[model samples]
Target: MKKPFNSKLFFFILATLFGVILSLPTFLQTQGPKIILGLDLQGGLNLLLGVKSEEAIKVRYATLASALNHYSIEEQILLDKLVVGEDNLSFELLDSNEKSKIDKYLSQQEGLEIVEKDLQYTLALSANEKINLENFAIEQAIGNIRNRLDQFGLSEPSVIKQGSDTILVQLPGIKTQEEEQRALDLISKGGHLQMMAVDEARNARVATMSEREAQSYGDVILPFINNPQQTILLKAIPILDGSMLTDARAAYDNNGQPIINFTLNSQGGKIFADFSGKNVGNRMAVVLDGKVYSAPVIRERIGGGSGQISGGFSVSEASDIAIALRSGALPAPIFLLEKRSVGPSLGADSIRASLIALISGAVLVILFMVFYYGIAGVIANLAMVVNILLVVAVMALFGATLTLPGMAGIILTVGMAVDANVIINERIREGFRAGENFIKSMENGYMNASRAIFDSNLTSLIAAVLLYVFGTGAIKGFAITMSIGIIASVITAIVGTHGIFRFLQNSIMKSGNYALWFGYKQQVYKRKL
Candidate 1:
């Protein structure tokens, strides 16, 4: 009755081989595990950023005021004392008759409500408009930060919104303080780059004008990044901005110094070509966050929309700038509310402690199983080892990240695996007391014990799924490992251990030995026919 080729045995062998192959890279120390380690385990930066929502509101009003200025010039309306407030823009009409005209202009605008009181006209966003604007700003900030991180080349970063105006960032495996700061700078920089024409006449006249007097001319004087003492006068209206950029990268200049090379979209390309073609000799300032990085003269019409920003930058600085530029600007400024860096040495210590706990737990479990059930216990111990290997291999295959909590999950799985063997071995002892033959007793034990095993693991799997859905960071890591471990345990307990018992049964039958290895005395009792 011995079968030469058993499907269950074949499956068990194949799965073990697959698990070994999947885990070989990590075992050999040739390469790291396919599963990544989280920030807590690997050591990196954790940042909490609060978005300046008021800044977004201010920028919105500034843009509206610029539009209103254009309308006033075009319509030839004389308005006085224009004021920009936190939520509204107000102006007084010199003539009351112009109220109707202003009302008509405001009615045409979307998301704006016009109000008139005491000859003062106020334009403000409606309630829905305010909510929409705030949400849009937050969503835009998230998108911009994700793009920046992607370009910065960090793998498996967690960039998520913590609350209405807060963002949580966790970057794993960053080792140096300089690198961490560089990443923080790249994420928070607004990166509002602009190309503006230099105003030579105003530049000369601004030397005599007071700061307040110079502001009335609607021109901005910004210091150069390389030489802060030297300043340039640029028109407030930009000829081009970062919004039109399509790509940017870091490159070396002719002198081997680092610079950022950028390209524009088709429309921006045509605009630059037209502007540079007409003003070939004038200097166009490359401004970023109100600081002029460079002001190069137009030698010829730069038709390709390609340009470089060079200002004595190191390689890493230039690379950061290029990444920020390519990712676009944040909708609003982000202030760091809290920052914590985990040192790699601490992470190493943690790993050491977790490994010690795991090895000690596994050794104790293996010894107990072997001492309790004799040969059957040894089979279960073997299955437990395979269970752990398969769990790790599954994690590697799925590219899951492991954390301290995840290591705890694995240890818990070892106990769960032993639980399965205990159930089956106890059922086998009961069947032996009922006077069943070796093969029949083993068959009944596996059949009767599998139902309880399936039900318990099923409920645990459901809980793991819920945890994964609702948890964050390390909790999620725990859920993922626990989930994978549960599945691997079921396979190893039912299929792997059973296959070994089947092989043992065949060998015992051939040797004419009907000894029970269930660690219990057999009783001569009548079978319930």
Candidate 2:
């Protein structure tokens, strides 16, 4: 007789069929959504870095000095000297008449302390503002590092804070030394950009003058990036800096040499236009991290806030620098505290060991279930198999990363999935011992088992969610797989196995073979109320 249309059975078959199809990419390397192996499962680079928040404050001070210098030039304020002190700035105003103009500008700025004594003005960052800036720098650095790694097309890169001032980074598929070095360079690149005018009058003495002597003349000495042996002198104050930069990308120059094309925001554009328009026939140095990359003479007024950096770069170098610039400069320098690399062989061994443990446990569970419960155990084995498949299928569909800890979660899931079936089987055997018929015994078995299964699964899912929220990297991976497994087990164990019992209810009843199906001897038990 045809079994009446059963929704539970239909859903079981539908879910099983979909799991197989959706998991094909992960199982067979087909063209579809697939799970990605993380750092522990695939070779990669790991780094621990400490952010120098103090240096960030210094960078902030230098930027402020540049702004003040630009303000002086814009307002035609003469200054005998403008110096950026370690924690404060001191400048001597040549004209006391324009002091009111400078005072108005300072008043408009926030988080600053200013004082005036005769022709001298002092400016410093407030104590509370200093702490805030330091904290902001660390947070900003983390964001910039993550952004740069994402642009590299890496799969599942991990970037997170470890402590108050430290960052942890993991990259999944860096196999060769070259790839590792490239990533390290990109991560550690300061990316500080500045546009300073060449000190034309004193630049001729750059090759002969000491840094101290150069600074005394209100000039700074820097080496060309393409030729470090060739030193140049530049004005201490910048015409503009990267704070106004909006976009940068790797491109080729006329000679097909690699270069980085950059675009600036409106403020920077006007500054570039104003500086170039007024300083025609003079040279401006394009400096990055205090090293001059290029010094080009201003031919005419350059507009549109666009410029390019040419340093005789290779394609990869240019691309990396472009990514750094595009992501915005790191607020502070990060020092590498530790470096470690995991090899492919180690990853392979981990995979092999995890598989061995998983297969061994599953096989033992299958054997025990079949031996103890006979045919009823076979029904559970079917649900158990589908449960495992569904777990992998869901993870593949979501493109989740699988780490070693995640493999352990799956192994634990195998045991948990079978535990539910075991409860149902034991409940049915108890029903038989109590003199119940086949159909009624099966109904009582599921009814008793479902509550216990639901409660356990719900508690486990809650724990998994908490782990995901508070844990980082590998812990999160484990929680993710464990959570998916819990949901899959509920569907295949309680719902799927119950559907199977309903579908075969008639066949077993006609045979009257309780002993063979359930490992129980009803003939030995007395009928009771």
Candidate with the greatest TM-score versus the true structure = 2
Clashing pairs in 2: none
TM-score per candidate, chains pooled? 0.82, 0.90
Off by over 4 Å in 1: 2-4, 60-124, 135-143, 153-155, 208-215, 274-281, 427-448, 510-516, 520-529
Error of 1 at 509 (Å): 3.7
**Candidate 1 on 1-529: residue-level lDDT in tens?**
5564567778888888878888776557556557777787889998999988667776666557655654664576877756666688877788777777777777888898888888788888888877777777778888889888878888678888886789899999888978888889899888877788898677876556565554455566788998887887876556777778899899998889898999999867876887788889888999887789998888988888899999898898888888888888776899999999988788788889999999999999988886677678888888888888888888887767788999999888889887898999888778767777667877899999999999999999999999999987778888888898889878888888787778777665454333335553443434333
lDDT against the true structure, each candidate: 0.80, 0.89
Among residues 3 or more apart in sequence or in different chains, the pairs in candidate 1 whose N, CA or C atoms overlap within 3 Å are: none
Q: Highest lDDT among the candidates is held by which one?
A: 2
Model 2: lDDT of residue 150: 93
lDDT of 2 at 157: 90
